[model samples]
Target: MSQKSAPRPPKTSPDATRRSEKSRRAIYAAALELVGEVGYAKTTIEGIAARAGVGKQTIYRWWSAKADVLLEAFLDLGEQAAEQAAGPGAEYGIPDTGDLAADLKAVLRATVDELLDPRFEVPSRALAAEGVVNEELGREFVAKLLDPSLQLYVRRLRSAQDAGQVRPEVDPRIALELFVSPLAQRWLQHTGPISYAYTDTLVDYALYGLAPR
Candidate 1:
């Protein structure tokens, strides 16, 4: 008997690859827009497929649930924002310019701008509201989406410590909250105006401490 050969891997054409990417982005855009407009509970995979102008099978092939789709979509959106702010090839991380305060201010000012973006704000609010009531999603999204960004702060703070800008004994994770929490509360509560100036002041207070030197 002749020996059997292993099956060859399927090859995809460049045009086909481009088409796949286009469809994926369309799905992400549709998912975000729908969730923002209707809230997560009301948003459906079918709706996303329809808005994306792709078959339901296309979405099903890529994502098992609306949550998964939204998760990836938000991640992609963040990447796009980073690219716009930091230029092409920008991966998400805090920029260290040796001057920790100036670097923090730059990042936070970008954050202030992001909060004001309608494309980001609406869908984010929907997801955040859901996370508030749904404990599982709350933990999941926080861990997956929010924690990465928080860790970047940790990394930056640790670097600051190495440079003697921050106290060596300080916990980078906890120390970051001094600046981050105030901005988070303002955006979530809509209790105060958010601006670069406000974030700059927060950074000043956080880095130098509220007491006099």
Candidate 2:
């Protein structure tokens, strides 16, 4: 009896791989640019496909919806930024030098630089504004993007508590908002200028009480 023939692997080549990578980068760039220019409400799968010079089917092959595309695009942007900041293959995390204050300052200063970067700023602002009003999008944004970063702060603060740098009773989740929320408000509301100096001051005030010892 003849054995059933083995299934052939789907065709692929180096050139095809290169083209796929190129198309993906174009889609990501187009999505970010469109969001920055027109805001999220106006950004659509068709627009992204037209801007990227790819068929909408190309996008649909990978993502089910515009939100998925935009979310993944933002994630890719963040990964690129992290690699640039920390070097290729470097894991992203807060440093736990015995000096909690110094570590916090360093992180917040980096945050200031990231916030001021136009590539990150404009598209991020668009998404942030949308998330404020779109409850479903807001939940996804928090779950996928915002909460992971916040948890990093929570982990760092917990470390500080273990080291006696923070109060044992303090909730790391809430404690983090002391520094994080103010910077967010300032940036989101355009209430004040954001700078390394400003973030450093935030670290100080969050760690130290307003009243004198």
Compared with the true structure, what per-residue lDDT tens digits does model 1 show for residues 49-147? 999999999999889999999999999999999999889997778889999999999999999999999999999999999999999988989988999
- Global local distance difference test of model 2: 0.92
Task: Show the colliding residue pairs in model 2.
Answer: none
lDDT of 2 at 114: 88
lDDT of 2 at 38: 99
Which candidate gets the maximum lDDT versus the true structure? 1
lDDT for model 1, please.
0.93
TM-score of 1: 0.93
